[model samples]
Target: MTIRIGWIGCGRHATWMLMPQLARSGFEIVAVCDRDEAAAHAAARQFGATEVYGDYAEMIASARIDAVGMAVGPEVHYRATLAAIARGLPVFMEKPPGATAAQAEELMRASEAAKVPVTVGFMKRYSTGNRMAKRILDGDAFGPVLGIHGSYMTAPTYFAGEVDYTGFYLHHCVHYMDLIPWFAGAEFADVQLRKSVPGPGRMLLHMNFACENGVIGNVIMGTVQSRGTPMEFVQVMGDQNRVEVENVINLAWHRNPPFKAEDPQATLDPGCDTLVWTPNFTAAANEDHKGYHALLLDVAAALEGRASPAPVIRDGWLAMRRLERMIALIEG
Candidate 1:
């Protein structure tokens, strides 16, 4: 019983990331679409999709797919997602959510109005290591969180061009931006940003903020990151314990630390333990990263009523508001 999927935006992301996962997941690719006809045809051919479309509305109105995966950029995310929602099917949309708070809110309202499930593409939340870390942090062992420190850096070249695209932080950092408070189960309450413009399309930001739940946060971002650098980590310090997820897929959780005290009597209480998790890619499949395949699988479950849609539309709106707040603090 393969779920039939209709995919919009057959560009780099769909071609390079989403399509392969959809194909490998055993979901029927009913239709592939893009503004570029050739790209749509190419995706259909590569992914064994039976239909192709140059227009998103036509694809939605015409295809018989059970779900839609939209990888369009932030600029048109609102419109594309609206179309998918109106079609009354579950949807998976790429992140940064909508460009504005109004757009994000509208998406949430529309999803609610139509009773269709929609999840944003904050795929980091679905990563194996992040999941493990979240489970531990959610347990009683980690207790109440004290502070969360997260850092994400990527080349602005990722966005390069496109009208009204807010540089790197607003455009690409939403994944971690969404994950910060998410790990702590809180909402962003305040933010302070000190930004330095390095050059065109490049910025460095140092931010400190707090969640409504009284969890403090610090984040550092750079748009000129090296091509291969994986400078991303989220460190959460709790009641005498700590967990950090690195590069989205590696995590280290530390519990109990032996104090190098001048008094050796503390040795009796010594219990220093560190546990690490890394993806064993030895026989890894598309589901290894928990991004592509995992998301699609989750979407299928959500549409089938087996489980609730995760990182739902409400999450997207919240993340967008956070990104917008950061942009305001910086641009002002």
Candidate 2:
């Protein structure tokens, strides 16, 4: 009962992160499609896909694809996904699902009308750190969350040409925007964005979000740092403690002081240490940090009537709404 998957867009992300794992996961890569015919053929040959097409429409029409993986750019996502949904194929789309809110809404409507399943590629929501954070929040172990602060900083070299392809926030920082609310167990009420061009080929963006649970979040992203530096940090503060996820892999927790103190100097006493903290770090054994394998597994399980998709269509739509609001704020 192997699930046959048709892959649309055989670029670096697909070749490096996806195809290699499909074979090992018991899913068949039945067909491959890419704008570049050569790339499509190469992927199909390497992955043992039965068919290859330069046009996704051809692949969809001819291949026995039960599900589709869409790794195309933001601009193409809406049309590609809509086409698949119309054809009655379940789809797993890459992040920032579409370039605009209107496009995402269209996909949602189509998905509903077609009665097919759709999932967004906000992989962080499936990460080990995030899973643990969700558990703690759900169990109320962190008490009522107070707020969150997150940062995503990357070197300019990483954006050598991506700025011309996708907006900085959409290409890179959308992950933070999408995950903040999920980690805080809330949805954004409003967003504020501030941007600056400090130098050539460089951009800095600051986003402030007000969440539905009375939690305020601030996210800072910049493409002006040196290479090899830590690029991401997420901190959630609760009533009794706080947790920090560093570089998207490490997790650290600090418990709130058990007793109220009148002054900061009181904690400086040699025997008066108040905060209790524990730290743990584990490398994700899987290759894709977003748990690509787990996602596909979930999809298969859903297809088998075992489990439902996480970060389903509605989750993707909510993230897109926040992204649209943030983009408008930045542009205005």
Candidate 3:
């Protein structure tokens, strides 16, 4: 069954990232909506959407879409989601579901009451490297976890026109921030921002978090580094082994076998093998690249009961809360 989708915002985000992926996802986008009539018409034509609406309410109420894909700004997410969920339409909302955790909580509660599932878009959770790392780490193949350290730094070219790197992180970096506790299958028990400062292309922040799983973690993030390629790394150290997700392309596992120095020249010991995986580039499918389309595919399956919806409202709320707290420390 095809899930007919109604897109609520057709700005540059929709044009560049969302529309291309949506067109490739195989789901039907029946309608496009935006306050700007020209943007709506362009998006509708580009994505094969048959209908265009300048009013979001009219689009949601009459487009007959199975789900709403919200690509709008954060300020309107709360009320817009409430209105959609009230009408029994499942929604796939962009991350940082709301500007504040309070707003997310309210939307969560409303969705709960309406029995409508909400999927938050944190596409990094769908990245090939991220998935492989989480799979191996969750299996505990390396024994109990010791700690986690992660950093996301690079250019803020995507949202650069709207805000700089630091501002972008505060608003949208949840794409990766939410994955911290997610991989542990735990929630954040406590968090403290050790440092938050500004610099040229250096929206710098350092944070420490205690997870419910009894693991301590630290994250260092910045966008003020360089206009060069973006850099991201997440590493988890286990009892005697470790796994590292390097950027969006590689998953490396450094292993330690139980051999106790059996040979002096064990330079080729298989026990200490460092395994690496990189998804091959293929044009057959958009989801093959571990892109945002995977998230949409998952959302479609989940809405149809074929699988579970993840990075849901709770995760979005937690991510937003953590970011807000970190920002509070710096702004206050």
Every model's TM-score: 0.90, 0.85, 0.88
lDDT of 3 by residue, 79-196 (tens): 7788788889888888778877899888888877877888888878888888778778768477777688988875545454455444476454666568787776677778787654
Ranked candidates (TM-score, high to low): 1, 3, 2
Q: Rate the local accuracy (lDDT) of all candidates.
A: 0.79, 0.75, 0.76
Top candidate on lDDT is 1
Best by TM-score: 1
Candidate 3 accuracy as TM-score: 0.88
Q: Can you write out model 2's per-residue Cα lDDT over 111-198, one digit (the tens) per residue?
A: 8887787778777776655656656666745678888898888767645643541566666767776788887778888778788878
Count of backbone collisions within predicted model 3: 2
Task: Tell me which of candidates 1 and 2 scores higher on lDDT.
Answer: 1
- RMSD (Å) per prediction: 3.1, 4.7, 3.1
At residue 227, give the lDDT of candidate 2.
56
Per-residue error (Å), model 3, residue 328: 2.5
Model 2 stretches with alpha carbons more than 4 Å out: 24-26, 157-165, 256-290, 303-306
lDDT of 1 by residue, 125-237 (tens): 77877778889888877899889998888776755555233646555667767888888788878889898776777777888988889999898987878758886888999
Q: TM-score of model 2 relative to the true fold?
A: 0.85
Name the weakest run of 10 consecutive residues (lDDT summed) in model 3.
Answer: 158-167
